[model samples]
Target: MTITQRKPLRPDDIIINEPGDQYSCDSCGCDLTHSVRIKCADPLCEPGDGVDICPPCFCAGREFRHHKRGHAYRVIEINSYPIFSEDWGADEELLLLKGIATQGFGNWKKIAEHIGTRSKEEVEKHYNEVYIDSQTWPIPKLDLQFSVDPAEFQARKRRRIQALNDTPPPPLKHGPVSLPGIHEIQGFFPGRLEFEHEIDNEAEDLVKDLEFGVCLEWDGDQIIEDEEDLDVRARAKWEEERRNPPPPAEKGRIPGKGPMINGINGYHPPSENGSVATRESLPPKSDDALANGTSSGDGDEEVEEVTQPPPIETKESLAFKLSLLEMYSQRVDKRLEGKEVMFDRGLLDYKKMQASDKKRSREDRDIVHRLRPFAKLQTAADYEVFAADVLYEALLRQRIQELQQYRRLGLATAADIDKYKSDLQKRTLTKANHRDYPTDKHPYRRQSSGPDPRRASLVSFGGDSEGRKSNEREATPRLPGSSTGQGPIVRKLPTPLNLANSPSLHLLSAAEQVLCAQLRILPKPYLVVKETLVREYARRGGKLRRREARELVKIDVNKTSRVWDFLVQQGFLNIASDVSSNHASSSQDASTASGSQVNGSPIKDPRPLSSQQNGPAPVPSTSSS
Candidate 1:
């Protein structure tokens, strides 16, 4: 096999060449136009005009006088590629700019002609792309000089002032003023300044043939001269007419006639019998008589009334009014045509439209009512979406309930539920197995030989048998001499028992025992009264009055009063700081009495003494008083 070498590629082969390409390579002296031209990237390498080299020179790594092989280089291919559009050429862009400068902007046809290579549309688009849309292009700033001439400024100011002065004052009445006969024109929209069918639809014909143009001779000087001449002529004519007044003719007479009646000018002569004719007697004028310029009344000096013709309108004014009316008529006709087409197509059927509107309204009302609870949802779509979500949630809740029921029945298929049931069954079996083993931890689990009579009887009763049995056992009558076998025997002693042998008396102090004996109160009753009085004293800020203390002890008022006196005498109750000053001597005496009674004997039975002696027992005088 023979080995063949491939030919080297040229820049022109990759990029199409254009006529405007002018760049040249410095190393090989080759035209760099329409090809990739290499330039030194270093700014200091070549200051203004950088060295350019062809692609071949760049590939060969050839060095020039100003550019070196080591220096970084950038490639430039002028006219080889388009920046915006592929079809546009660089020369065409140059032509576009030249055309804009010569023919001015907006003259797209002339610009396109100048740029013969591109059409007007392409030229306009290219210009806009480069100048308006592209940021790379620089925009020229205009230096506008604004100066107003003194004479022109003064003239403008004067004209403005005159215009302000000429402005009409506001009317006294200010409101929506209705024009007379405005309602006669059907479909007349004042806001739009248009009307329906006009009264003279053919008014445009009047001015159709009239041609208008500027008359150069009608300048200010000519107008003023004409006005002056017209004024002088009018004055001369008025004087001549004033001097040339016609002579008065004979009343109600015509030449070679008897008395003329209703002759010319509708005048009438009087009757020959010297009777004044009444207006009712005069015959009315007929159409023929009016056409012939004559009247019907017969009198000496009376004239019949005649209607005058209206003033004639100018051609221009009449045409303008007619044209406006015609335009309105055309508009009305066009609107009617559209309505007629709609009616013909059955789109404007009143009954069908009304029914459809009512159905739509009913559906809207129903939707609004149904969505009233979800008022936060602004749009119908939002409401519908939310309602669907709610429905889905309800389905999920029902499914969850079904699953829960399945789980409760132990028929669930879920792994967790099955695992839980298995675990529960295992725990139950394990407990049963544990019970069978009879571990020491649960001694009650030991099997009994047989059911007890009490348990058997309790099982036979449906109610709380244990509670009933307990109540019965507690209610069982016991002899006073008998004792319960549970613990120590506690005897029920009489209230008059000696305090030394009383179980409750040992808990009291010596002074409390002595006080109890003196009051003829049992140790229990004495302690109860003492606690009540002390609570009342503390509640009243440590001050217990005699009557208040007696009220607090509800057991026996006389015995409670004695106990209160004993407690007060022993200084057990003291007045609060507020009343302590008044009870200073009493407090001092009670303190001395309490000190002496601290060593008193234990309580003795006071019940027997109270029963034997009717008089009050003598109390100890422990205080100094």
Candidate 2:
């Protein structure tokens, strides 16, 4: 080897130059000088930067793109070596350490990607040399002492163990005892069966035998006597017979027996002394008490007629309640009076019942004839409805009467009077107008009313034709949720009778009946007069004389005469005067005008005084005589 001076190449020159001056192109095999030759830019290549390339390799940006983009090249000049920093800076070293920590050692490809500078091989070599082979780590050693006296160590170990042993053991904790399930218990004890298998098998065999058993010989006598006795029906019959046996032959014919002595009384059947017979066991009629007698010789013996007294009436009595037939009769009477039947008729055949020549079959005709005598001739429902109607009509009439009285006294107006009549019609008459016609034009609007062309004389029910037309004009279609904008005016009727003095007042619903007893009476003398009338006569004891009653109510003698006269004229009190004597007044009857006598009917029209018929009149006040 001759001693020759060689110039060092720059990093850029080294990056493109081949190892030798003249080299074959790896791609074309052309011999290349340093100026024309370049190395492959891939750092991971086997001969990194040593492979020779020609200028053609740079065409179309092949080496300049992808992996080789931004790669450096060398510029040759006079002899000058490249200035390169081979040692890493502090930041680079830190990056290298962090990359190793994250990517781990020998993962050079990933470490290189992270560090962004070194090749994988370079990174591997650096990491292995710096961190593995040449590394000196500071590992702290624990300064310890294991050497000890045998006796002392043994004593300390024993002492520690003794302390642990000396600590009192925790009290034994008892939890709820969990019992095993049936199957679990059976499984645990394999020899034992869960149920009585033999008993079950026997039962199953018995049931099977019973299902397909031998036929039995019929023992009629045994069934009739022995087994039949065990039957519920037979036992019940036997018990019944034991409880109520037949009467003794000696005591059999007790004449004039039972409640049938009077046919009007509740008919009881004939039986033993203690037990009464059912209707089926009663004897047939002996042609005596029945209306049509068959025996001719028995005409000479006068048959005693049984008379029944009227039923006892009490405070709790419903006896005064009218039968449905009576209600129907009352309705017919009212209908004949040329007035609208003041009640709901429901589905009643009132027209058919009234018509004499109405078509009907023989049975229906017979039924109608038979029922004609009874007010309860129709169905129970018809009767119920009829009674209700009569009651309702009666109350309506009473209210009408009260209204008339009120009007007479100028306590109520004509409009107020009309309202009650309208309400009564609405309640009683089903044919009354219900639907309102639209004032506005509507497709389903009610037809406007006009006189029928066929009829020369127009007729209307209850209300007059002109009033009906007026009503029709006012009628307007009501829409859901729309306000009528007019509130109904309510008026109270004037009560005539004091409820406390009336005996049958309890029949009316308390909510409906106005207690005149509690009314706010005008004129202090009027109240005193009423009090005196009620106390002296209407109260339990007996009637009082006029003088005593006037004194009791604390009215003056002259005022008494005026008040008494007023009461009598108003039909509040009934007084019978004595024409025999001038000074002494006869026994006065304190009649509160509670109601009418027919069915304890509601009060009819109250006849007010002639003087007060047209307008309000001042209460008569007699001056001191």
Candidate 3:
């Protein structure tokens, strides 16, 4: 191969570049050689000297007019998908379309019509950015029935029929878990069968090294905005369409499928040899089968009322729990133990029942008139085996819901709080690396370390939340942390458990422990009052009573009397100096003479002071008294 080298000219030959920068040509293939301070506007041109042309061609002068209007274009509004990211590109639009398209493959023709773009090829080429008329997402008034992609959609339907032969998902409690990250296929699913099949097959395939794939569902008529009128309308439309099922695509037409039933909590009928009969073909729901009761949901079928068995005494709770579950499983839905419903031994459903008195026979007109009222469960788990108590079970359920919600909303769970906080702290530290906490090096106390149960929850929850997840293998640690095995981690015990040693005091009141903790955190000045001020504040007849002192102990507030001033000055009161400021100020004003006099010389005031509240105060010489 021969080495090729382009001739280099003086600085004039090359154009220097800065970002937010551009240059362009008069024609598509043109270039410019001359450099100019002005910004180039032609899209086809490259930056260079005054001669505007394609950077390579370097000949045609700039032709495209610059559309500069001084102020940059303000994106006051945009039309976008609600779920799409702020920087959503064009392919996302197509992906979103594929997800929501109702017409299937034929819908591609309307791509230009919907977005006002020129052609399908153009639409795909410029998929990164889709300019919209509105600055913010606008919900279009036009209706498009959403359907699945023809190719994959047909494949999914075929798979669904064949999937009846596939194994069902494992139960919620155990077996190989269908964790979102480890085993899940992201898809636009229609019904429970499709969803569960996807989960089971995808999870198995996932573990077996099958790569993840997308299951896009679309056509436009997906989520109905008017949900109150949705079910009835969708059912009517589905019935109409099902009665006149569309012709095969060889003649060039869309398939008339019924409304989506996935992601809903509803009754599912048994499938026959993988073919689901059209609802139109099925006999109308019998009035007798439904007890002629009113249905809260918009659909025609009324809900069946159920009579619950009487509550059992706590004596045989374990047997009662099993009986109740069995009854509940069999009560309303007989098809529940159907082949599809029952998973293998590890495939048992981790169902929980909560006690509720709301009648299944009630005439409640609310749209969501309770579907099924479960009896109130005493605790989180269904079976409160002697092994798992209320606290442990509640903590576990709380952890699950918290994690699930956090995962769904993409937020930090209580489990991640500490780790997140540490990360945040590190980021903040970077901004102030040289900054220091003045007392860190000193043997000082922390004022912020006041007693708080929330603190205990935070510390305990933070260290142990990650382990609470269902996938977590090890048993939940009863103690605060893995390190707790060696010994109690005093620092992590929340506010030092300062009163934990004082059984009597601990029994006295939790309020007191909290108050004492606050007191421990406060400086001596607030507790100590000057002798004169204390007498004045207390009134002569009121001498700081023992009850009063004890009551103040909760707040760690002290009367600035001879007793308090001495204790404070002697450093008997331990807290931040700012806390003792009140006592110190009072002591300074009252003078140390009062303490000295009480300690040394016998003394009495020459004039007796009296207050309206106290009546008359005595002034006696210590010598005589």
Candidate 4:
């Protein structure tokens, strides 16, 4: 029986009854025989509250809950039938159903919006409980057999391989592939398979001719059976054409000229009909000639070979001559330039060498001045001691050689005797050379007397003069008993003769003279002032410069003070002071003095300072000595 439809059926339509069924659902017209019924308990059947519904409408809560969304509906006991739990009534279930239809499964927020009173979580829970968890349909079982039987292995393997080979390769991905959604609702919809099949068929048709073909190998050197083979007659025909080339055409030949003239001479200007003759002389059109020589033709006149004259002997090309001249000039210029640079370099080197020599000389003089006192302490004895081992070894070897010669001969040979004598004399000279002069002794062993040798060397001109004089006198020969030789020669001590008044200072008692001389020689400031003053005094001729002396002693400018006062008090340095006052003390002492008069400007004390006060003296010696 067909039911007349006035409107499109929704999910509620499927739940409705056939046209003849009784005890039917009011919303869907379904019979309540097997379906559970939702009968309203309110006594308001004519007031629209007693309408009944089938199990689907009750479970899905279609029009039943749609109409009574604001009202409460209570369940009444009916004949027992399969029923959904009443805990989630028609409203909640219907909301879920409508929500799924409108918004699809996962979007529960909007689903909840359609499901007003229910939360998205409650709707999801109810749907999961009813449709997913309590689902009556079982999941299709996958009968996967991971282990194959050995007996069937060959058949199974062959089938698998054949399937793989027969399977078409996947279509080439042109760009990015759009994958179908795993949870897509469209898969559950009807007619989707038909749409998919239509799309695949159209795609196959478009790509059918675009498939890649099988690949094969080829070699160019091998001739294939499909190529034509030549016969002997064909080869003969080719040779005959080559051996007898066609005679020259009229246009190629000189017009109005015989064959003899054309053969001997090369080309001549064409006659008046050259254009017409050229067109006519072209080879006839034929299949064989077109295939053989269609591209060959004599359009140009024959060229005669001519012997060329040897190139004329002329002066070199202007460009080449100019280039050679420029090269030579550059060579000469470079030579001169290099010579000039070398000369300049040599001159610079010479100037540098001269300047370096001058600077080195100045440095040497300064070094000598600084180290003079220390150098004077090292006499020849120190050098001899340093080389003693070498000298001893040399002498020992010489003696041994002499002994050996004498033993071999049983007597000393003249050459060996002479060598031994010469060695002895040489040893004596070596010892003499090694001796310290003025008194042959080591500097460390000798006793010292006199001022510091540094001071003596700088200041005591008188001592050096006396030593020289004594040396001269000692060098003169004398008879054994001369009066001067009878006793130790009496030598007068070297005083500053330029500053002495008389030689009779020995007339007074030694003590008194010592006091007077001490008063004359050493000033009060001598120790502190010695180093600077000695340097300055040497700058002067053993006389102090008052201005330089003031600067030298100027430790304190505020005090007028001790500066140069010692030299002034001793009357040794002539400063701006009364000469008579400087001499008064000396004159008064001179009148009361016992014998010799003391000169006011006397030289320093002649007697050497005690040797025991400082270390030993260096024996006097020149570096050469």
User: Which candidate should be chosen as best, given lDDT against the real structure?
Assistant: 1
lDDT, candidate 2, 1-625, per-residue tens: 1233455444443221112124565666776632455565455332543555567764544542233634554432211111111233333455667887888877777776565545567667765655566435222122323444545644554464456456553444343244443334323222342232321233333223222111122442244434333343444555676699866533333334435433433336445676656556665666564556443324644433433322323322322232333554555454433212211222123344446436645544555455433343545567556655655665688788997887785656778768767876865542222111112232222111122122211222222335345433333344466445432222332343455655445553442233223232333335546666766655633334445555676634434544444454444554322111211332333222111111111111234657435543321111111
- Better candidate number, 1 or 3, judged by TM-score: 1
Residues 136-213, model 4: lDDT tens digits? 633212232334343364354345445645655444434323444311322221223222222123333333343221
Report residue 268 deviation for candidate 3 (angstroms): 60
Name model 3 segments beyond 4 Å from true: 1-199, 203-520, 523-537, 540-542, 545-547, 555-625
Q: Name the regions of candidate 1 deviating beyond 4 angstroms.
A: 1-21, 77-86, 89-125, 128-625
Count of backbone collisions in candidate 1: 5
Q: Sort by TM-score, best first.
A: 1, 3, 4, 2
Weakest 10 consecutive residues of candidate 4 by summed lDDT: 594-603
Compute the lDDT for candidate 3. Answer: 0.36
Clashing pairs in 4: 16-28, 17-29, 17-30
Q: In model 2, what lDDT does residue 600 have?
A: 18
Against the hidden true structure, what lDDT does model 2 obtain? 0.42
Structural similarity to truth (TM-score) of each candidate: 0.16, 0.10, 0.15, 0.13
Backbone clash numbers for all candidates listed: 5, 3, 66, 3
lDDT of 4 at 141: 21
Enumerate residue pairs that collide in model 1. Answer: 268-299, 269-299, 269-300, 270-299, 270-300
- Worst lDDT 10-window in candidate 3: 616-625
lDDT string, candidate 3, 284-321, tens digits = 65577447655434564443333232232343554554
Assess the local accuracy of residue 26 in candidate 3 as a C-alpha lDDT between 0 and 100: 43
